[model samples]
Target: MSIATPQNPALAAALILAATTFIAATTLMAKALGTDVLGTPLHPMQISHGRFLFAFMGISTGVLILRPQFIRPHWGYHIGRTSFGWAGVTLMFASVAYIPLADATAITFLNPVFGMLLAIPLLGERVGPWRWGAALIAMIGAMILLRPTPASFQPAALLALTAAAVMGMELIFIKKLAGREAPLQVLWFNNLLGLAIATCAVLPVWQMPTPAQWGALAALGLLMACAQACFINGMARADASFVAPFSYATLVFAALYDFLGFGAVPDAISVLGAVIILAGAAILAWREGRQRPHDRAPAPAAK
Candidate 1:
């Protein structure tokens, strides 16, 4: 049986909000696991490994319970999506380990900007002047956030930016696969393939987690699974453009988690830059949402 797609707009909005909160919680968990902020610090790869491993466990269990026939889809697209997604996740975890959560999250918003550029060649999508202008504004926002100078440059920010770029490519693959595959199929393939690939790195530097650390890792995986489910359900229920803008709430949740958990506040420049980037993204989403009926294609899947 297919998963139920929510039809109520209010419920869909609530689900999106919940999904963003869960995503923000994952950043906090990842930071705690990968940094000395909480339990024993795990290597970024180990953290990535645990992320996918536990996510696979949780999602697979759900599939068994709700949709046993969901397995064994087209493997080629699955591999492509998982490969890009794993690389993106690894870099993003590394970025969070070194940089403030808010900063890293803000940099990742460039996925949409990069997506527009990739769409031209990959999907034969047209780019109009308005989107080009939005991309320019977003680029300026990235610069303002990075503040790349001899005295103020941060290499770590580049990691997040690179992750965003990889995720943009991943979105293109998702677009290709979405039409032929169910959302749960894509979700299962991501975690399952991610776990298999991440294991290679984990075996070399694995440290047995303490009970608390194990709990954290498990929670991280569960949150990710839940978040993805909510995200897909919301998108299925509402217009993709309507759902897309709420994703910026991840940054808000990140900033809040940073302040309350780590006491690391984003400086003025970072805040302003985040606002600008969000504005550009909103413009892009709004324009895409307004596309004529005949011009509509699948909107990029949310992370």
Candidate 2:
């Protein structure tokens, strides 16, 4: 039987909020896996592999139990989406190892802005002044996080920015898939393909995870799967714009997780940049909500 998901804006936002918690926790897990805190740092590719492999396993089990029916998929869209999603995830794992999780998470809020810009070429969508202005404001916010000055420049932060761009590209494919199939089916195909792609990419960097590392990887994968499921079901129930702002709660959870897990607090710049980015994103989401038809919404939250 398909899961019942009645449209409930309050429930959707709550689910997204739950997803943010899982997402933030996964980053903390990734940071542990990527650094010596858990053991010797794992390669980002290897870490990404763990995420896909274990997430696929968990989702495969669900497929067996739930037995959700699927439509004939758009193979090209799934491949494109999974490939870019895997790359973005790998880059995110790499960045968390080197910078504060709050900084990395804040920087990645650019994905939507990047998605808006990318739509011009990919979807033939026209950009109005509202979108352009929102994108500009968002870019300025990202620059603040980059702290391009010699004294504060952290090159590792660029990985987060690039991840945002790649995820934005993934968003284009996601838009193509939205409303085309059951959300569960889309998710299963995504992780299945993600596993295949990440497995190939990990060959050069693969290492046997330590016992504790293995556990962390397992936790990371499970958390991500849960996050994806909550996000998908949530989006299906509400306008994307209505719940999109709630997703920014990830930064707060990240900062709290980082501090509790590793005692790292968000410094001044992290808070300022994240706030500005939220402002820009809120503008874009508000505008998109007003202009787009009620049926059009983001497919799901891409972690």
Candidate 3:
């Protein structure tokens, strides 16, 4: 078994930040697609279809250019992971349409917490007090930031909450595949299978996009592909629990994108909640760095 140690934290941080930026941009695009901004709002299924389709094209191009040797994938893990991923993304897209983007994004903060907890069983990663404390504190911060009045928890808000749960589960499969194959190969198979799955789901709801929507879809797909690539590479460099908190950075980018694109400003509660989450993450990350048990460079090439 690979010892649990910190990998290249700096490089991992950089990659994860890039992923959050791309992911936040995709969220913005998804919000636009679900609204009348691009003529008619596309269905969440249709939007996800576009994400997989374009991402596949982009990854396939890379596969051709690099011509890297491929490895046999753990198909079971891939299938489970992709299934959860598609569901989570579709739900996330749907939530953005029914609720404020800030609120939708805030709820997703729980995903990493869910991921950390699930990692205990799924990834067989040991969670110390620091990890548990960090996760709990982040969860509390998320709830506080959400400011759940009786009316605050709208029925539609459940969509984002559910998306978080599904995505938390998605992280397990990602961790499982993190270093088992080439990152590019993993992405290629993921997008290829994702495209097939999305196609089947979108058939009933598919409609030709206006030229503008088509452009938006292309941009969204490319951005999401970049996010996935960064995320996978980042995972290769670090353990999942250690990387979980860094994902909160996405909230920052998400908030910025929502405000810039749609003028959804965050209130003091949102700011306060996010600060607490970051604080917990910071504490955990510091502890992880200090321990440094799993510190080894990646193999020159994945076999």
Per lDDT, the best of the predicted structures is 2
Ranking by TM-score: 2, 1, 3
lDDT of 2 by residue, 1-303 (tens): 233457899899998999999999999999999999878899999999999988888888999999987778889999999999999999999999999999999888899888878888778787788878988988898999999999999999999999999998988898887778787888899999999999889999898889999999999999999999889888888878888888999989999999999999888988899888889888988887887663232332557
Give the whole-model CA lDDT for all candidates, comma-separated. Answer: 0.81, 0.88, 0.76
Residue 290 accuracy (lDDT) in model 1: 81
* Overall local distance difference test of candidate 1: 0.81
Model 1 lDDT tens row, 39-113: 679887888888888888998998888874564577887888888888888888888988889988888888877
Instruction: Show where candidate 3 strays beyond 4 Å.
Output: 1-10, 123-126, 237-246, 284-303
TM-score of 2: 0.96
Worst 10 residues of 1 by lDDT: 293-302
RMSD of each: 2.3, 2.2, 4.6
Pick the winner on TM-score between candidates 1 and 3: 1
Clashing pairs for predicted structure model 1, backbone only: none
| Per-model TM against the reference | 0.93, 0.96, 0.85
Q: Name the runs in model 2 displaced over 4 angstroms.
A: 1-5, 294-300
Report model 1's TM-score to 2 decimal places: 0.93
